[model samples]
Target chain A: MANKHYAMVIDLNTCVGCNACMAACAMENQTPVWKNSWRTYVHDLEIDPGTDHQVRRRFFPRLCNHCDNPPCMSVCPTGATHKLDNGIVLVDDELCMGCRACSMACPYDARFDVSYNDVEQGKEFYGELHHRTRPGVDKCSFCAHRVMKGLKPACVETCVGSARLFGDLNDPDDKVAKLVKTGVAKPLMAHLGTRPNVYYISEIERAR
Target chain B: MEGMFYSTQNVWTWWIAIYLFLGGLGAAAVVVSCLTNMYIKTHKELVLWGNISAFVMLSVGSLFLFVHLLDHLAVIHVLNPFGLLTKPDAWIMWGTQFIVWMMVFSMIYTLPYMLETPFWRDMPLVGTILGWFGWLGKLSLSFHKVVGWLAIINGVGTVLYTGLLLQSFPAVALWHNPGVPLLFIISAFSTAMAFLLLVLHLAIKREEDHDIKVLYERTDVILISIELLIIFVFFHFTTYGLESARHTADILWNDMGWIVGFIGFGLIVPFLIEFRGVTKGWNSATPVVLAAILVLCGGYLLRHYFMYAGSYERPYPAINSIHSQSNYNLLIE
Candidate 1:
């Protein structure tokens, strides 16, 4: 009833496995400098067990699934974590009890602990005296803050190929909706029932 | 290998191990104080309910964590939970706070009831307020969620959070398997049972009627049976998956599964001792001691595995190795 469903369409056909999307996400969100992946590429299969995995690997970058029934949301003791009407789960960093329950509840390892920069730490101070902190969990928000400002996500705009599409699936007339109407997309880790917003359109299975 | 793919219980294992041990300790402390309340029980022969419970709960719970944490703190760089989120042990910040609060509160609550007498009627009131706050500590048990929705958030949150910690981890494939949370819920029930037995033993001036004692012990028996089953199934999954799955757990244990600890002196042995006490009807100080020891040890073992197996793990090889294995390229190439 709350216009909460979100949809993402990723065209595997055009994706050249470039990591522009991940970089864009990191920079746009001002993610912690030392944090690993804010978003990542998952694959339909594990890499072929070989020494040349990176070169042969078909990139399946992934972000949060924004499930309709997030286990993390239900288990929040302080109500610090919640799913928005748009189906994304966001944490109130200010209110978080600093408990790791939601991080634990996430089936996809979607929650990560990162100490957000107190102020926008410019690139000059990229790596420096790091401090241990009572960390909170972070995940992709579909770049919601940017979307409301009437701009495409940095990742979507920077894509060399128009491979990533973000829009309201609820608007049947929207482009993402049209693509979803025809594109056979799959959510990574669908078996876990997180129902991620990012979807992949693939036609063939490659070597693992 | 054992808990691979799943993540919730990895955290839950830690929460349960810590909380379960702490929870037992809290209950045990109450029992010990109850025994000390000589004013309430006039007929020593009537039956010692409260004091017995307190000692059992305290001794057993303390036994479980005391030795293990001594070992862990010696090596870990534990950061205070109040700090920002940069620390690896940040998740533990809230958990440790909860454990500390609960232990203190349990002591406070037990003291008033254990020492309740005509001379000091108001002493229990001080404990009551603290008890309320301590109960509030239960909400903090989940650590990830903040304190928002309502006053009751922490207690209910602890239950679910504790459940997830054990079942959510990745390498504890079996612990995070389908039945672990169910087991933890049962563990809470068992902890409650252990708590009650300590109550029975600590009766001060009067002895509990034989019938009420029977009820509590029977409940413990049934719950233990259910708990043992849960543990059995959990082990079944871990051992089987460990044998077949990928990852370090396949080796019977990696450095991380040290949560299992040294063979005879390890956590499982403590559990076995309790199990033996349960079967032999060693319900007095012995069962309480055994249960407290085992459950607490079990809880620590749970956390130890998660720390050892998942999260804050060493980085992937500096060189990307995803494609070298046949498993990587087809998925990637």
Candidate 2:
């Protein structure tokens, strides 16, 4: 099979910051309920100068960018964090020594701590995945399991505003590839040279 | 661009700082011990102390790192040699392998001398087991210069690795500077000398060897001065380079607790006292002990402050999530 380059595009203009996607991701991935789960997050871009809740606010959804040149993968001492043939970054929890070096290397701060042994709760939610059974570094897998089954990520499927889109960028006819070719979708911190797969499309001017 | 999004709290804590400090101390001890043994004929006592110190400090340092892991039992994963050969960019893998080799070499270098001691002589079984490899130590002595040189090279790698560990973290501006390795290497040697001085005075009661004592004291004074100068450059470069680095610089500059306690009292005072003591030909234990203690504490605190100074660039700072630190007042405008 040809290699796939999966990517996600979050439409900032449509996102309500309701965190419905976050909930869906947690349920689907069996991520930690603790405050620092890494599956996905919503950042409210406070661009407005007024007190009005209805105006000038942009909800920016963030997850592991799963970069083409992931620094996190580069720094992993044990090769626990790796990029699959499909372009999704993954952690081999069994191989992870809980060094936290990869977590420090991530520019987006997308990685989370799951090195504790008491994390049976996430395992109970996820059942048995050979790599993710034990505690180690945690981050978004781009929902590789679902994507492999010809389905969208839980977050993309459940987005109320249809704000999230996921598809194989390798397919030139894919919606994500066409949207990216349009030049409106911007990857966060593009200058960092990670070549993040996650992109955002925004109508509002970014704050200086 | 600054103060947009307060940084999410990082997971590394004081344990990591202490581990870095100890790793440096142990590396310096090993290097200095090997150098002294090779070059100076009359410093057998100093070499012995350095060897023992290197072994103890490095072992304890590795223990701290092992304990820092989220799952303490899974440490064997780090021992896999596949990571080292396959991943050249993995400094942690390099570090683990280096330290393991360092420990082995340190034990090899120290065993012959240890056998000569009354404790080892009393246990003849140790001699019986060690007799098989006794030729290695004898061979080591024949090529003592070469062995010592190898130790020095590995020691330097270990020290630089501690700094490189932090430098690889490109996100945290405070930890990503090239100056980190240089500063850490200098501090490691200084603290290692201080550690030796304390042991010489307290454990061996070696007040007779004024020449060696004065040499260490003079060297530490100079190291402390170099440390201050490097710190100045570290701050100057960061403050002018990028906004995130400037944010880290601001945090460092405003931190009166670190400045007054660590740099001022712990570092500068020790330098002044040791310098004054060395120049005046004053040979009191009080001044030496005080300076040594200060240098050791100051080195540890420098690592502590570096961890606290880590800050991330908040490009989209408006999202006030529960993960955000509460102390940063949100921009009202």
Candidate 3:
């Protein structure tokens, strides 16, 4: 196979705001549940609130963009944040000094600090099988561990509406590649030049 | 409506602010002390005390930086030389190297003066320690000029790194401007003068050091005036440059700390005091000392408020499109 360039596409139309992805991510990643921080979460957005038009609800799920030009990786003093050939960004816990510079540099607000206390709490919250063994800056890894094992991310696998799609963007046959090639899905804040791998498909307006 | 979609960055808190302030102040003091020793007239007391203060301030500041880290034991990772070679553009890596080298060169520069001091030469434990390093001190004195230049270069690097560190964070609109580094560099020098003034008045009250005091006062007056102009430009640029920057400006302007504490008390108060002392030939130590103290406080407030005022850009531009219409508003949870 050609070099894999992983990507994700989230179709806003199909999402039901159930937050299954958030729960699955928290459980699989051993996130700080008590603090309510997650690798991915659905934002409950109110559009045109208090306007003459009917108020509309939008469920916007957010996670690390895994940008081609990752600022977090460049700003990292210890080179703790690194990108794989497949375009997945990962943080080496042993090398991360937890300066939170990566958190500040990320435009997506994806990175979160996992303190020593958070690691200690993970043992109890995750029932002693917690994989988070050290304190460092944490973020969505695109579930690289599972992706390498030929399985989808926890968020995509558990998505109830099947709104989240994950695949190798390099493969022209992949659905993600088709959506992107056809311009049906768009990346957020493209003007920022981060070249985000995560794309979004907007909801189609119903005929009045 | 934009407030709901945009969030203030909370990653860098008062710890980073304190570190930035102390780092700039310490580095500037070292630069000023070295320049004075080399060019004008050498005052042993100023050189000795100034270097000591710089060393102590930087040490305390680095300690705070270490405290800010969640993984303190992993600090060794920062010291790895390969990181610098790999990511040469990373300011944090440069900052770490600058701070460490600055401290090392500063100590070497201070070694000869420390050995010459009667306090160190006569004190029981210190005298013995000096005796052990007698050959080293002779070596340092032999090439003191080279050591001084190296210290000066690293000191300047450390001072610039403090501002460049913030400027590298493009996500925060308030910190991404070139004006930040300019403002920080000027403030660093200004604060250094104020600190030296305090030392001159309180610790080493020598009549022979009148020229030095006058030089510092004159230099500070010019620096403060430039800083005021820069502050004006900073606010103007942020207000008109980008929407996210305007939001950060709104936050900063509304805070009484930035207004009354930094601008009114910190900048204006000290500027008037020092400007008057320099122009009118007023030799009173009382008001000058007061102005110096206020300047120091102001320097710290500058970093603290700027850190707190950093606001991240809206994550998604689609929200902008939806909210731009007159009848639309976005409330993000």
Per-residue accuracy of model 1 over A1-208 as CA lDDT, tens digit each? 4383666787766777677887787677655545353544334333344575553434455666677766666555445567778766777654554345566555555555543342234243444443223335566777777777877767788888878887887888778877666656666645555556667776452111
Q: How close is candidate 2 to the true structure, as a TM-score?
A: 0.89
Segments in model 3 whose C-alpha atoms lie over 4 Å from true places: A50-53, A204-208, B1-4, B122-128, B315-333
Q: Which candidate number has the best TM-score? A: 3
Candidate 3 lDDT, B23-106, residue by residue in tens: 999999999998998899887788888888998999999999898888999888777767688878789899988888888888
For each candidate, what's the DockQ?
0.08, 0.47, 0.44
| Candidate 2: docking tier | acceptable
Which window of 10 residues has the lowest lDDT sum in candidate 1 chain B?
A: B314-323
lDDT of 2 at B155: 80
Number of the top DockQ candidate: 2
Q: Write the per-residue lDDT of candidate 1 for residues B168-282, one digit (tens) a residue.
A: 4432344356575565555554555455554455532124444444454555556556766665564456555443222424333444345345223233454455555546656
TM-score of chain A of each: 0.76, 0.87, 0.95
lDDT (10s digit) by residue, model 2, range B1-333: 632553533456577788889889988988876776667544656666887778788888888888777656667756766757777888888888777777667667766676566665466787676666677777776766766676777787888888888888777777776888888989999999899888778877765666667788989999999999998897787688777677667777778867887889778899999989888855468888988999999999898888767766755542222223542342222
Q: Give, for candidate 2 chain B, the lowest lDDT window spanning 10 residues.
A: B318-327
